[model samples]
Target: MKKAVTILFVLVFMCGGFMQAQVVKSISLNSGMVWSTQKFDYKDINYDLPNEYLTGFHIGFAVEFLQHEYFSILTEIGYTQKGFKLEVDITTPDFPEGGLGTMEIKYSYKYAYLSPMFKVRKEFRGFIPYVFIGPRLDYLLEYPTDEFSEESAKYFNDFIFGMTYGLGLEYMFGSFGVGLIFQNQYDFTLAYHHELEEGYDSGVDIKNNAFILDLGVKFYFGKE
Candidate 1:
């Protein structure tokens, strides 16, 4: 949408100013474990199946804006997977000639995600502890492979906005840094909507959430 592009452009312009004015830079390679699920909200319909967490992996690269051991801006970009597993119970007298059957289905979606965060840290004897909070933007990579068709994919969103918050610890080995971080990610949009032929949606329908633990290797310059 035009409005979304405008907002993104403004944020990029502001970040460029900050980068030019202040002077510290670090680049990192990161990957982690993700436990994700879809939560549903509805006014009239309810999902009867039991949903559980789906496990996936996240790998990314991050750039830092400052060298001050106290505060900085971190911008990260990564490819990740998020989804839920559903358990459904049904009587199978006709389909399989059995009395009961339970079917387990998992829905996995791939995304390109970006996070630009404010990082604050304290350093003591080559060890650093930090916390970060940021806004996350996710772009859908493709329709899920299971139970999703091209027609059904139109109801899904291509881009969604969310929040990512976490805490991490790092150790400095001269010019190199290694860290492990714990993060919580939550999206604020519907996975599916039925009003394409009608009008705008009123409220949330289904949202995605995840818990992540990441490990990273960092290279820094302009540090004290």
Candidate 2:
């Protein structure tokens, strides 16, 4: 992480002298779809289950460091919800006084994420194409179910971390700028849940990977 920060600093300095002024500044709003394609595994136990991938929406913003037309420093924050669905089938034993029974258990796990990005721009006469890459930090806000009998949930919220990279196009329109961008992130940490309850203390797990794609527009505050 220190090396990454040093590299980013070097790139920033190489763009221009310390006194170089910003040519543009902008704030963007985005809304797009995100998806995850992975399976869940119980971290501490052998309780096996089948789960399907999950999907949701993303929203965020971007800031530009306008030292050079083709170069800029950028940071963005976004929220994501992705997880898996589990389905289990069980057959009940036949009762002499009653009848046999079969049932299916279904549930899902969701994760929330916040990402900070560093972007580099490639300039043209009227259109600017840029690529961005950065490290992301995530926190879990909720669990799958409320089956725990304890007053406070015993499950620990896991941290999700990953890397991101993608491209975008920005158009110059005087003081205000307009653009569209797309990017994807993959988590490197496994997300799991531990049951501390006495009787139903079975462990649960979720997929470790996810992807996000976003489209946004930026409005520059200062003119070149």
Candidate 3:
């Protein structure tokens, strides 16, 4: 974990140097809705958990470094929310009659994310179309604690890594612009911490996935 964080920061500094060499094109503030899907792996459990799409939100600021009209580097930092829901039916010894009914569990996490992306853009008659791909480093700020199962809480991780890619369209009006952007992110690492027991050799793997739809405004300085 420590090594991963160290490497991420190193990349950040390297990107910073690259940004300093380029011309700053624009700065933008964005806010919108986020929908997340989570998959859970139960090593020994037999119950089937239903998949759900959970809704959340994100707000952030981005800096664009442009070397040309076709290519640029964008770096953004934001507050984002991601989570999942599970519904399962369980049968235990205590409920010999039939089952303990349906159990519904929801997990929500708040994260601060730093994303550095490479963007490709093209200008149309009155609009700009762009696509971006990047790595997102997220630090967990809040974890679900209220009414959460002990087993679930034990598996949460403090840091997560993901990849984000998206496409958007922008309309510029003088120094200000408004646009819509769609993005999707997938966690490459396990969302939870898993430890092996005395006799077990492996742990379960869980992942989170998210989709974002953003309405953003950009202010271009020294350019009209």
Best by lDDT: 3
Q: Which residue pairs in model 1 clash with each other?
A: none
**Residue pair clashes in candidate 2:** none
Clashes of 2: 0
- Write the residue-wise lDDT of candidate 1 on 130-214 in tens digits: 9999999888775575586775567788888999999999999888999999999888776566542334333235678988899
- Candidate ordering by TM-score (highest first): 1, 3, 2
Q: Which stretches of candidate 2 lie over 4 Å from their true place?
A: 1-24, 42-50, 86-113, 146-155, 193-205
Highest TM-score, which number?
1
Question: Which is the better candidate, 1 or 3, if ranked by TM-score?
Answer: 1
**Model with the higher lDDT, candidate 1 or 3:** 3
List model 2 lDDT by residue over 15-114, tens digit each.
3342255443566777787666555465457754555556666676555555565566665555566654444444345554433443433333454444
Greater lDDT among 2 and 3 belongs to 3
In candidate 1, stretches whose alpha carbon ends up further than 4 angstroms from where it belongs are 1-22, 46-49, 90-101, 195-204
Pairs that collide, model 3: none
